[model samples]
Target: MGRGIVKVWYDPEGDFLEVLFEKKEGYFRETSDDRVMEKVDMQGHVIGFSVLGTRNLAKMPLEVALS
Candidate 1:
């Protein structure tokens, strides 16, 4: 058994980002979503991950976020 997951990867040529949504274990099932990728810089201490909004995506820094 495995955990459910979503993955984000860089797309340099398209100038956009790729998102992969997957249901873990059992069947090999996965799909992708197209998103405009950008970088996010955190203040204070960078903690665990949180859900992001459209506005948050817009505010991120392209250089760092792509990683």
Candidate 2:
């Protein structure tokens, strides 16, 4: 485990949300859910995640495995 600041961002116009556990280069990949994406480094460790259609979450809670 590592200790560091976690970053969160939300775009009202896009209805999207993103969270980052580490500040580094990574690429987003598909997860079990289509609305969710996991960002991973070259080594495949989960560094962050993003959510699409965030505004719809109010009607149904989002649930998806990161790794």
Q: Quantify all predictions' global Cα lDDT against the true fold.
A: 0.34, 0.91
lDDT of 1: 0.34
| Residue pairs in candidate 2 whose N, alpha carbon or C atoms collide under 3 angstroms | none
TM-score of 1: 0.27
State every prediction's TM-score relative to the real structure: 0.27, 0.90
Clashes of 1: 2
Backbone clash count for every predicted candidate, in the order shown: 2, 0
Model number with the top lDDT: 2
lDDT tens per residue, model 1, 1-67? 1345556655455454444443222221211222332222343222112222333466763223322
Give the lowest summed-lDDT range of ten residues in model 1.
Answer: 24-33
Q: Return the lDDT, model 2, position 66.
A: 87
* Candidate 2 residue-wise lDDT, 1-67, digit = tens: 2578889999999989999998879899999889999999989999999999988888978889888
